[model samples]
Each structure stands twice: as structure tokens, then as C-alpha cells.
Target: MTDKTIRHIGAPASGRSTRERLNPARLLSWVSGYETLVLLGVLIVVFTLTSDRFLTADNLQNVALVQAVTATMTLAVLMPLIIGEFDLSVGYLIGFLVMLEAVVAQHTSNPGIIIAAGPVVGLLVGLVNGLLTVYFKISSFIATLGVGILLSGATQGISNGKVIFENIPSSVTTLASEDFLGLSLAVWLTLLLAVVLFYVLEHTPFGRFWYAIGGSERVAYLAGVRTNRMRMTAFAAAGLIVGFAANFALAQAGSANPGYGPELLLPAYAAAFLGVATYRPGYYNVLGALVAIILLAIGFNGLSLLGVPFWVQPIFNGSVLIIAVLVARQETRQVRTG
Candidate 1:
């Protein structure tokens, strides 16, 4: 495996032409590849000028905390996307898991067991998703959408259509209460997850294999990569990741509410797509996702400070997602044409 070579589908997405390196068009392409950063800067400047609160410490901390769960969910979305699969169930899945955690907390005084159940059950959910897509040959979108819907109902049923908040241990809440170096432990944990994933996806042989699979499943299979198994593993791993995030979320809120999952789903996807158009261009990378997450966080938080209506967030997210997909396509096309 070490001797094998796996080519990325978007290796040249960020590569600029040396012949006309300074040409306006070339420069634009390069800039567009990193437009998320530029957009983030613009949003920061605009919001700072527009609202005095934007630059304050309290507001900044709120921004980070608000996007913390989305940041974690973005990581969950990244893994399956790298393998060219979509897990639409993620938002619902994680939401359900959080509710489940609250239920566990209410039922037992054993903190460790309550916390431990999240990832374990999440892993099983991921496996089910894998089974649907791999063995059953269902479309990834359909399979995940169905799972998400099912979980939405399950979340309501198990929690009796009410919020869950009782006997959740202080340890669970520590993730939100504790902060080191000006960031919550949950935020630090999210960053750590991003870094670990960056390594696994960019440095490890497994990462290369994933790129190969994303590039072309048939080609990877012919090259001796266990494509199906890897795809399944990706979903399962994503679920496990989301499970941990759900726990952090449960810790932060110390409770769970129905309909919490769907709200983040669109934003997570938007951030993931924006990531595709960021640092690595057409490749879905953790670093890119982080930037995109910050970009979205700033944009959404800024808009809120402007006193916009609640409907604006979804509109903004939809618009960003559309723009991100277009940019990613352009990057991919540029490389393909070259």
C-alpha cells in the first residue's frame, strides 16, 4: 500500500497557470479558490463597521459558541463527502443522539455510561446507513434522507415531543463551562478533531485511498482498494464523530429539544460545500471546512446583529451553498480543461 500511488481528483484545483501567472483571469481564479477567506474578511469588516457589538469580546465568544456544534457537524459531513457520498441524516442523527443522551441522563446517575452510549449507538446508526447504501444499493441521498426522517420521528417519540433536561452531570456541562486559552473545551475538542482528520486525510495512506475512492470508485476497486468497505467505514466514522459532537452539545446545553437537528443540517452542508471551494478548492479538506465554518459563523452572526428576521439565516445559507457549488464546479472544470 505504501508503494501504491493514489491521485486526487482535484490536485490542480488550486494550481495556477505559470505561463500567465499574473494575468487578471488567473489571479481571479486563484482568489476565487480562496474566496471563503476573502468573504470572511469582508464580513468581519462590514459587521465591525455596522455594529459596535460585533468586535466586542462577549459577541466574539458568542459567535464561536454558536457555531461550535456546526463546526463539529461540518467534520462529520466531511468524511462521507470525501468518499463521494452524502449523509443527509447527520443533522437528524446527531439531534436524535443528543435527545437520547438526555434521556439516558434522566434514567441513570451513571455519567460515564450515559456519555458512552452516544458514540456506540451512533456507530450502529452509521452502520445502518452503510448497509443501506452499500449492500442494499440504495442511493446515498435517499438512504440518508430516509434515515434522517426516521430519526426525526424517533426523536419526538422517545422524548415525548418535549425537551429533555434532568440529572445531566456537571461533567457533561463542563465542555461548555470550561475554557482554556479563551476558547471553550468543546471548541478546542472540535479543533483537535479537525487537526486529526486533516492528518488522516492528507498524510495517511488511508487518506489517499479515500481520495482515490472519491475520484472513481471503479478505479479504486481495480487498484485493490476495498471501495465498498471503505465507503461503509466512512459513514460509520462520520456517525461516530457526530456522536461525540452530540455529547459536547448535550454538555453545552445540558438538555435536548426536538427540531434542533434540522436547523444545523443546511448550514453544515453549506459549510462543507464552501470548503470544497476553499483552500483545497474541489477537494473536501478539514482546513477548508474550518475556514468555511468561520466564514459562515461570521456571516450569520453579523446578520443577526443587524436585526434581520429569522428567515434570513436560511436564505443566506441557501445563497452561500449555491455560490459554493458554482465555485467548486468552476475550479473542477478549470483543472479538467487544463
Candidate 2:
């Protein structure tokens, strides 16, 4: 069989205009995923013109470091979205997982132990979510919202409304603080994870199955795709990613507070949603999420340097998410109608 990448190359551009025909799917694969490039360009122009500090290496590094945690969570949230499910619980789950990792490390002084157990807890939580949605026929949004509430409660209960800080060691701190090849460790990990996820979702049979399922689960099931298993596995994988993100945030903050995680959920989902509006246009993909997060990060970072209020970040994210989703929906509708 031809590789899944060729298949996901998607329908030919077939635009009515000559310009569109020049960049058909078969013609410009090398430059096809250039959404990131455009966003980067915007970043350059805006930062260079608006914020004096934005062009500095130190400011750039700070942006990368701060964005790393949100980018990680964005990728985690992308898993269920690919399968046409939304995971609202990721924010709340991160809170609990962050606290849980810190608490465990504090008691045991073993980062390895906490890291190992974090995903297991995430998996169990994901399983509960999947069971409720797939088996019990609950809407994914509602189910995940409920899970998020429960997770937040559990996190608060565990931390007793207090931040946990003293237990963090240098080892755990290195995960976020250390630089790899001059890039933040968190950003490096995000890049590596993106490549892995892209390969899995674009080149493998499972990747094709996810596309099929996302297109229409009933049809995919009829075509012999294991929709139930696929959904469950996707949710589980999302949970695992969220757990890792939780750890990254905890390490970065040098403290675990149940409040930190959910604040990021909006930007996380915004990045994922904005991703679908580019490159593949109507479909969600790994590179899209990465690019979207970078765009959002650059925009927010630049604004902050310009003395914009901190609350404006959410306004930007919320506005962008709505616009991105609307654009994606319109593209889908146009394709179907045309």
C-alpha cells in the first residue's frame, strides 16, 4: 500500500485560478506546510516594529520557555480532537497531575517514581472519560467538562488549597530550566514529540484510521476501522501527553498549584483550533497545532512587551479560536458544497 502520507496529502488544490493550480498537492509538497513560515514572518515584522525588546535573544528565549508548557498541552489536546472529540478536562487534569507529581516527589524524593506514576493516573482518568463517552453515549464535551471539575476538586483537596514548593529538586527543575542546543528543553521536547506524533498520525495505518474516524465514525466502523478501540486509545494517549505537560509545568514553575493548569486550557485549545485553519485548512494535524501555538505565543509575547495588559492575552486567544474554527467550518462547508 502507498504510505499514509500520500493519502493524507488530501484532495488536489484544483483551484479555479492559475495561482492555486501552481501549488497543487502534487506540485509543492516541500513548501506545503508553510503556515508556520507565514506566522513566523508575522512574528518578525510585528516584533521588529512594535517591541524594542522582542528582537533580543534573551527575550526570544524567555518567550520559548514560557510557550513550551502551553505548546505541550496543545499537542495533548490535539489527540482527541483528531478523532472528533474535545477534551476539556486537560486543564483540570494538569492541575491534579501537577500537584500529584510534586506531592509524590516531596514524599519520596524520587522524580523518576513520580514521573512513572503520573501517566498511570492520567490513563485511569482518561479511561473514565472514554468509558463515559464511548460506552455510555455521553457527549464528549459534557463528559470532559465533568471530568475537569472533578479533577480540579481532587487537586484542591490534595493540595489543601496551598501551593507545594519545597520538595522540588534540581533534577526535576532541569527538565524546564535546562537548554538543549540553545533551545528551551520544553520546546525541544515539544518539537520531538511533534515529529513523533506527525509520523504516527500521517504515516501509519492508525493515522489513516483516525482520519477516517474523524471524517465519520459510523462510516469508518462500517469500513472495518475499530472506532471504539481507536477512540479509547486516542483518549488514553491524550491523557498521557497531558500528564507529561503537567510535569513540565510543575518543573518550570518550581511549585505545584492546582490553579495554574486550567488557566492554560483556553490558549491550549485556541492553538489547536487555530491550527486547523491553516495548512490542511479544514483538517487538524500535528504541525498545524505547533504552528498555531507559536503564532499565539509570538502575538501575546509581543503585546506584553508593548505594555499590553496581561488580561488581553485571553482576549486574543478567545478571539483567534473563534475565528479559526469559523474559518475551518467555512472551508469544510465550501468543499462539501462545491
Top candidate, metric lDDT: 1
Error of 1 at 39 (Å): 1.5
Instruction: Give the whole-model CA lDDT for all candidates, comma-separated.
Output: 0.84, 0.80
Please tell me which predicted candidate would have the highest TM-score against the true structure: 1
Model 1 earns a TM-score of 0.88
lDDT of 2 by residue, 1-338 (tens): 11322113455556557766565654544344354456568667978898788898887787787777788888888889988998899989988998998889778887788776667888888888888889999999999999999989999998999999987877887888888877867778778888998889878998889888888999999999999999988888888888878777877888997686788787787788888866666678887788787778788888888888889877877776776667566655654575
Task: Compute each candidate's TM-score over C-alphas.
Answer: 0.88, 0.86
What are the runs in model 2 whose C-alpha is more than 4 Å off? 1-40, 309-315, 334-338
Cα lDDT for residue 159, candidate 2: 91
